[model samples]
Target: MSIRPIEPDDHAALLALWRRTPGLRLRPEDEFVPFCAYLQRTPGLSLLCERQGRLLGCVLVGHDGRRGYLQHLVVDQPYRAQGVARALLRRALEQLAGLGVQKSHVFVLRDTPESLAFWSAQAAWEARGDIQVYSHSEESP
Candidate 1:
């Protein structure tokens, strides 16, 4: 698979990939158009894995000057376990290092076993076992 930057034209394919997955957030296709535009303008950071003119997966790496966020990493089911996500991540980390980013962060949903396994297997990534993620929701008074 070839890893390349996301193009505005790839929006439809990206949307379709997400649609095939069950229980994923369903957003209007138009909602993602602006995101593609933004990503193109920000910098050439996001990478899309393609094979035979088909999008296989994607990863988005966003950063401020000091730190980086592994914003989104998703591989098509057929492409999983083939090192697509790993290659994407390695590229992102190399880019972040070039930009002088000393620290990086990614949050895996607690309920997803796949995510837990993926991150846990990364030898270079320190697993902060005691770290707890919290959130608050407000209800109408």
Candidate 2:
């Protein structure tokens, strides 16, 4: 698989890949367009992994001039365990470091095994003391 920067042309394929992936909470196609626009305009960066002309995985790197945040890391089920996710992640981290980011963080849902296992297996990932996750309902004030 080859990893490369995400392009405007890749938006549809990436969104379809996410929807087809079992573990992901799918979002509408239009919902991704604005985010793509933001990535195109800001310092944010995203990458796509393709094999034999088919999109296999993707990763997004977001930073606020300080810590780096990793999001939307999804590898197609057929390509899982073939190093696609790892390659995308390695690329993201390298790019973040190149930008002088001191630290990086990724938030995984509590019950997502693929995410949990991936992060847990990384030696650099550490869980600090007394971490709490906060969430709010969409209808809440």
Candidate 3:
């Protein structure tokens, strides 16, 4: 398998992959225009894993000058338990470090058992309990 930076042409395939993956959630930001904009904004931080021209998994990474944030970490069901996620994560963090980003975060939903389990098993990651996340959207009341 080969790991490579994600390109704009990858959107459709990635959307399909995320849609079929049971625990992944898709939002408006995942649409084509915004997705392309994000790639332009963050450059080569996001990545994909492929073998023989088929996409196996992907992770979306971005940073706000200091802290890095990761999203949409998914591997094809048949490819699970095979280190695809870990590889993607390691590469993402390495790229972040290259950019001088020392800290990173990923928000896993409380309801996704599989996602929780995978993250819980990661030795380098800690499940934070001391912080509460709050968000305000102009689109929400």
Writing each residue's lDDT as its tens digit, candidate 2 over 81-137 gives: 999988998889888888898698888877788788888898888865577877654
Specify the highest-lDDT model's number: 3
For residues 1-112, could you state the per-residue lDDT of candidate 3 as single tens digits? 9999999999999999999998788888899999999999999999999999999999999999999999999999999999999999999999999999999999999999
Q: How much does candidate 1 score in TM-score? A: 0.80
RMSD of 1: 3.7
lDDT of 2 at 34: 70
Off by over 4 Å in 3: none
C-alpha TM-score for every candidate: 0.80, 0.85, 0.96
Across residues 45-67, which tens digit of lDDT does each residue of candidate 1 receive?
77889899878888767777887
Q: Order of candidates by lDDT, top first?
A: 3, 2, 1
Candidate 1 — which residues are off by over 4 angstroms?
22-30, 129-141
Worst 10 residues of 1 by lDDT: 21-30
Q: Give all candidates' CA lDDT scores.
A: 0.76, 0.79, 0.95
Of the two candidates 1 and 2, the one with more favorable TM-score, higher being better, is 2
In model 2, the runs with Cα more than 4 Å from the true position are: 27-30, 41-44, 135-141
Query: Which residue window of length 10 is worst by lDDT in model 3?
Result: 132-141
